[model samples]
Target: MKKEEKSKPKKMKWNALVLSFLILLIILVLPPFAGLPVAGQRALAVLAFAIMLWVTEAVTYPVSAAFIIALLTFLIGLSPPLHGAGGLIGTKTALEWSLSGFSSAAVALVAGALFLSAAMQETGLDKRIALLVLSKVGSTIKGILFGVIIVGILLALFIPSPTARVGAMIPIILGMVSAFGLQKESRLSALLILATANTATIWSIGIKTATPQNMVGLNFIEKAFPYHISWLKWFLAAAPWSLIMSIVLYFVLMLVMRPETKAISTGKDVVKNQLTELGRMSGSQIRLLIIAFGALILWATEDSLHPFDSTTIVLLVVALMLAPGVGVLTWSKVEKLIPWGTIILFAAGISLGTVLLKTNGATWLAKIFFNKFGLNSLSIFTIVAILTAFAILIHIGFASATSLASTLIPVVIAFVQGMDNPGTIHGMGIVLITQFAIGFGFILPVNAPQNMLAYGTGTFETKDFIKIGVILTVIGYALFILFSLTYWKWIELLP
Candidate 1:
């Protein structure tokens, strides 16, 4: 039985890889349709190949990214250039375009953010902060649950990576469960763990740097539109929606997955003991806190207070944190902590999206999509509802919010650009709102890395996750519409 289980994954990968190659061949060979340029047709084919590989888990992300870059170099290079006096883009120039995403400031910010997450982990600061928050919340189950959300919110501000924030909290939360003498699978355990996972997702909606997907959205927005979304401006527009959803999360989880007891009488003591085990805060922790806090201020005041952008600020923070005699982490230690595969995949995704836009593939596809749905004739409110629903439903198949955002945001930008709205409907607003829906990975453990991290604790069943997840998804969708009609419109995010 164990042998069969091991072989199953190998078989699945072979099948998926075979299917991906077949799809790529068909698209490349099929006669052009929709008046798509030769380069555009080839770009769409590569995109379909990527989506299939990504959705099916046919290969590791960095491996798949390497495949994508290679294919783009050859396929796009062989096709006629989109413009200019050239027979073909040529493999040399095509490779350059394929690697262009590495040059983006978004890529730099993501790398810097990863370094910060590493520092938090290396110095054990993330764990200390989480335990400190729980220690102060008292022993009541309700208080602990609320504290989990609070921890998520606070960490999202300081830690830019969602997985790292949730990663830090999971062990501490499980410790609290053990301290209370509850079984790992107890209702109380499930409740607290689920809340921790959901809170991480909830707070990510508000903070621009909390997740990579938000950066993916910003990348597309900056490339396709004439707008620049400052950090403060993003907070002003999206934070209220996230705040309301955070409240909704508390109520829904409380009602659906009520714990066996109202209080963990020893919860506070366990947390206190854990905090005591660490003794006093170290110099490393204090220095990291100050540096992170200063960086946060710079990010929040990007456009208003000074001229430095968020990416530049993060780079500077990372440099300071790694400098000799002044930093919390060394290069060798931090390098292992960072997921270079994710960075490679991130850069590849940006390059693919840029190619889609540059070749007009996204525009052509968007036109067909809008016309098929008759969205072009609908009110902006109706359009938002339809698009947001599409975003939510499609998330079921995506394991990475970053992949979803990269694959779809470019098309969404093109969709908005093709519309007739001049000023009233801001493409940035529509893209931003849609980006929020892309974070709705509540339906399954496989929907996100954080969800999977929590699920691996074995404190909750799949059915339990599904039940609470369904509720969260519905609430998230409803809240999305509510904000669209009221706050989003008042703030000029919608029509």
Candidate 2:
């Protein structure tokens, strides 16, 4: 009886949830009544609700995403009817719009990528690669850091999921550190893990299929505009940025946390022993290696050498990976290993962003911002910088780079359209850098999916993340602006 009384009192205590509820109510009721178009207002209302849910996380991300589909399923009548599907708004039509995100090929790519990551872990292929690279890099702290980065780049090229990449790297790298008598919380441990985390995100912009967010941005362009950015073109524009940023990332890590012990001296021996323990690759490992490399070859060459889209090629590889006799993964094994929640989150974010563009909600939001701030008189440089800042700073509210890009890429596009007297160079320069910069999330654990995964390992604290994050974020943005003026201008791509 005493315990029950105490529990009842505890449950009765006030929480801050009432505020979120009030905010949600205001969004739902007031937006539809605003001077927005019927469709725009409804889309805006849905966006507001999504923002609240994402910020509070009162529910799991997937649940909140599911809520979006549920709400759109019922309340879609408030918006203008979409064309091409009976040319009217109805529950059926709304459901289709909401479900399209869940069904997008980008989401499938992420799912397939997850299964492939599971394959590496199950077949011990990831460990073998890690050991092989670390072994060749020698015993110096700098060399080992580079080794960790090399593993990250190699895995990231094929593994689209940052969480999956980090998931694979963490165990192998941590095991290696353990082999060397390093503690998880030490500077070296932190450096190694941070290198892994940093590279996982850094490579997102380098490869077309490297991250879902990149695809999300592409989706926005297709939905909002008539132009196309091919997989090869995206890589062409971003490869240099990625290469330079990678060098910068490595330098930043070295500058921030100079290891007390300059050289491990035994790293080679540790690598030798780890490789010896791993033994020769199994048949499954060899098969997975071939499949992994094959997928890479197709993705890299598809734009020039073939007609299939990136997603189609990815799905083909996935089908091959699970084929009965030649496959690397069993359905039973992948079913358990896939990050379904993230897949759902990706779907929801894409859906919301897609609907926002469809309903003209993104355009309305931009006009509102411009009117409120009197950005009407701003130059293209100022406008692009503000948008860039928004693109980067907005990560505070979202943990997934995919979600952040989906939500803001459309906004960035709208702002680009708003610019006046923009020459080809200025407009394209601003647009490309603003969109490309969205791939990076260096601020908080919730800023990037990988950050949260790295935080889970308990190797580094929030403070550790902030210091390095600031250095990278600042330099990254600065480099972006400088490149726009120099290299990008010289190449005539911006012009």
Candidate 3:
């Protein structure tokens, strides 16, 4: 019996491996015969092959993605516009286009914001705020859920990147959960916290420093539209929707889990005791708060002075927080707190995007869809919104949000032009919708770093994520479509 069981598994593995290789061979050889652009076909084939490896767990997801990037860059080089010797070396024109995204301003801004988030986490400022909020409003499970939402929003303002924000907050959240005795079987409690944190990623789209995708949106709009949407205006347009979605998410969580009232009581009493243990806020905590608020003001008003760009303001804040006399930040601790993988992931995404756009792969794919469907501007918005939701749903196969964003943004921009009003407001609307939709990755343990962190606590199951995530995703998409059509018009940003 034991030998039979072992042989069965071996046979399955051999069959699966053979099937994958055959499928890969077919995709590689068939696309050229189908009259597809060689570069675009090759890019699609490579991406499909990577996805297959990721799904089968043949290799780690990031490793698979990295492999695709290397294969595309080295094997194919430049396609079509510069063929033969020109293609081998890459055309001067292609170099100019691809290198443009490597802007010093974008890199500095991202690094500075990352440093600030690390400083906050290292100094214990985020924990203090979480404790304070829980102490004030966590008497009930519902209250705790609301508190989580508020804390998540505040963190988003400072952290910007969801992976960083989620990672930094997970340990703190787990500490609180453990204190309250809310374990994995307490499904409702776990789902509520995860939903609050995940949904907050959408709200961060309102700020320039929120994520690299926001910056990409801004750059695309500046190039394609006659006007620019300021950070404040973008916030105004999306904030109401964010608030509404958060409330809906809270209620949906309650309905799905119907957690026993007893679970709420266990955590409340424990949290109160922990609050007593924390005592009053320390001097370091107070200073960190001031630095955080000051940084926000600078970011909000970055356009005012000629010399003070978003990058400069963020760097200044990081410097102040890290300064020796400040005592709020320690070099040794901050070094440990920083998420180096996230930074590298961001850089790689940017580089890959540069290659795609330079090689006209993005445009080629866009043209295929546009010609096949005959979609106009409004139709394009609908298509993009739907595709964005689907992308988020299957994002477990993706290693990083930046990776997903880099791959999708160009295609999104191509569709945006189909809209009659592809100006600042419409552009902002599309960007916000895509960013928010991407956060709907609630199905698997590995979908987003935050979900993975939350999963690690052993307080939730994959099914728990699916039940709540599905409902929230539906609500999110409905809200996105409504906001794009009506609210944006009321704000005079959409046609």
C-alpha RMSD of each candidate structure in angstroms: 1.3, 3.8, 4.6
The alpha-carbon deviation from the true structure for residue 341 of candidate 1, after best TM-score superposition, in angstroms, is 1.1
- The residue-by-residue lDDT of candidate 2 on 1-495, one tens digit each, is 999998764444323234444665576676354445666666776777777666656566787788777776666654556442544477777788788887877777677777777788778888788788888999999999998888888877767777778888898778878888988777888888888888887888777777777777776665555545666777777778878888998999899877768788788898889899888889999999999888777777765888787777777888888898898788898888877887888888888877776667777787787646866577655665677777788777776677677667766667666766466445555666667878778878778879888988888888988888888889878877776667766765454
Candidate 3, which segments miss by more than 4 Å at Cα?
A: 1-69, 76-87, 91-104, 167-184, 187-192, 199-229, 262-269, 304-307, 330-332, 377-399, 418-432
The positional error of residue 339 in candidate 1, measured at the CA in angstroms, is 1.0
In Å, residue 264's CA in model 3 sits off its true spot by: 5.5
- Go through the candidates in order and give each one's C-alpha lDDT: 0.87, 0.75, 0.62
lDDT of 2: 0.75
TM-score of each: 0.98, 0.90, 0.80
Query: If both were scored by lDDT, which would come out higher, candidate 2 or candidate 3?
Result: 2
lDDT for model 3 comes to 0.62
* lDDT at position 140, candidate 1: 88
Candidate 3 C-alpha lDDT tens digits along 318-367: 78877887847777877787665555445545555555554455666666
- Most accurate candidate by lDDT: 1
Please tell me which model should have the higher TM-score, number 2 or number 3.
Answer: 2
RMSD of 3: 4.6
